[model samples]
Target: MITMSPASSNINSTDLDYYCTETPTVAIIWCVLGVLCACVGIPASVWLLWVLVQRQRSGTSNDIYVVNLTVMDLFYNVGTAPSMINYIAFRNHAFVLLDEILYSFSAIGRPLFMTCMCMDCFMAVVYPITYMKMKRYRYRLLSCAAVWGITPCIGTINAFIWYSPIPGALYWLLVPTIAICDLAILYTLRKPDPSGRSDVHPQKQRALQTITNSFVMTLVCYLPLMAMGPFLRLMPASDQVKFCVISLLVYIAPLLGGIIMPLLQLHSLGRLRGLLYCTRDSGSSEQPDQQL
Candidate 1:
């Protein structure tokens, strides 16, 4: 939280020292609201994950990916969401740093895993046969392990760069990569079947549309958080303003992200939109292991 005192331009002009103090009444408002949001949002996400798992015991590839994303969101909100309160408490500096670590883990890990999820689904949609032959639980789990392990290391380094007040950009290069893959998958899915037998693959079209909707929602939610990167250092403002803005941004991104995924899982697929699962045979009760 940013301190709400009068603007301090006399302090080190290079660094705002954001997050070292709590903002005024607004900080209190945001903290209470953030805690309330987390309390309400986390359990809904849990129920959503359970719904995904119950819908398929062995779980489709998409189910696994969704479960992974839910876990990341839950961890983020539960672990780091209270940092707002901690900021208000103004306890030991060490505790503050610890929360930052937790924040970094969620922030870095979510996007890293999201990029993987997008790539995994893009492959499933754009090249189903090849993806199925190679997609196994072991391989998918390993990819998830890589994301969790790698992103935090990079995040720690970037955190240091920012804290050091170094002149640098904090963009996570994965954003554009994920966007391009999604656009490609969407294009490929919408392309006409050369054999003109599109009638046979109505299920594919529905799945692709649902997946596109998910990606578009995620992209929209991320813009508020990611758009702040370019201005992290360059955005000129009072220390109080910078702190308040950053604290709000840090929590707002997660609040939207944590809520959006479960909402997508539950509401994005209503009767009007068709079931999230698709089947080749009308009478078959079982669905294939891969989903968009």
Candidate 2:
């Protein structure tokens, strides 16, 4: 069995005591949020997967990256939501290994997906001509495979290496990596369109805007968690505030990423709108309607 040292044990004790003695109102709020997240995230993620798979089959590249992003969000929601509910239900009891695994996967997967989406945006903006020339469906399939395959390995390694001895450094590294990649994506968006035109297709522009919004949403959700790490390590003994804050932020970040990001995309991307409302005589009616 994994054992805690005196200091670590004391820290855990203090944390539990804090939670037990703290305002019940805060706990109720967290529980309500947790339930709401699970209720909304679970079905939305499933729908996103169904929609993406159908679109993939029909070979629409217009929002393939968005589809991949939706899949990642699906994984996050499916993996994380129940665990959050359980944590709120159980209130700091020892979680099973399966819960640990799911929680770890969700934590790591959220950031990894954001990184992959940023990379996808970079590819779309920096290599527009190349992206247009290629067989986008095939490339998207390969890219999805790479993101799903590679992220678990990276997460596993990082978890083993950093969770115990060097939490701060690991978080520092992760934050910077996320920040840099996001900045690169932002820069890519700012560059002049190769066609030398001020205006682009509404669909294309919306797709890009969806990516931008997703990135911003991710950064906003995660910043608090990242900022909390140093404070957590430095003031490890603080009982009422630190643990509650950390737990709340950790849960909220993935909740927002999984639930909010896709909704943002659905609002921004007209393809989904078109697919959902095929009877409407919008600009979407002109295209050769692909299956789903």
Candidate 3:
């Protein structure tokens, strides 16, 4: 008589083989969307990082948050590669854990970094005195370092307990916090400048608008995934239908976030036109020169 090992006694080889061989529709859609987003987001993020590094100065130390956001975008977009390959090829689960861990990095990092940006803007607008006193590159760098160190631990937890709604709920909570900061900044920006410069308020208002738009982008990407998390618990672990729908949405949130984040960051920094429209202006100028 043949005997099975204790660990293998409960394992179902048929289910495992089916899972490895079958590609879900949601996963297919996810791979396609991920590829498209990576194409645009990767280049935009790299360019934005280049611009940020080139323009770095002592007074602009607050840009560390945006720089970190850009890096998160890079991780988010590029990290999809392994999952895409595995899913498209209908391969085994060898890379699934690694892919999920990579995703958790951005999933956790995005909100934390965005909260930092919101708070940075909030303090600058709402309490300039305190902001000025607290503003220091070393402090911000340390804060980012803490976040970097914390991310892997949290991400590892997330990877292990991916089915748990707790992680998703925690990140979802940041949306309201960021929205509150955006609202507070909006209220403050509306008041007349105490400095008595009417011209300055418009620029400030424009900046605030860009920041608000970024918050909106977060909502767009995050809400569906947040809403879907609870439903996951109601479904069975063996439910392929549930997996398809939830997995599509679960990954799409961060994919969309990775895609749109750099554009929003550039807009907030008043560099949107530099990325989108500056080349046209440069071309026009060169055309005139070539005619001469």
Estimate the TM-score of every prediction. Answer: 0.72, 0.68, 0.79
- What is candidate 1's lDDT per residue for 217-252, written digit by digit as tens? 557655555665456557677655666655464446
- Model 1: weakest 10-residue lDDT segment is 1-10
The most accurate candidate by lDDT is: 3
Q: Distance (Å) between predicted and true CA of 273, model 2?
A: 6.1
**The best candidate in terms of TM-score:** 3
- RMSD after Cα superposition, model 1: 9.5
Tens digit per residue, CA lDDT, model 2, 231-269: 566774555444454455454665556577666665564
Task: Tell me how candidate 2 scores on lDDT.
Answer: 0.55
Q: Residue 189 error for model 3, in Å?
A: 1.0
List the global CA lDDT of all models. 0.59, 0.55, 0.66
For every model in order, what is the number of clashing pairs? 1, 0, 0
Q: What is the TM-score (0 to 1) of candidate 2?
A: 0.68
Instruction: Give candidate 1's TM-score.
Output: 0.72
Clash pairs detected, candidate 3:
none
Per-residue alpha-carbon lDDT of candidate 3 for residues 1-292, written as tens digits (9 for 90 to 100): 0001111112222333323236456666677888788788888799889878876864453378878878877877776665676656745454665665566656677777777778878888888899889846777788789778866666566545523444566656877888888888878887786888776556586657657775786688766666665565576655444444554546576677777878776666678766468888788889978988
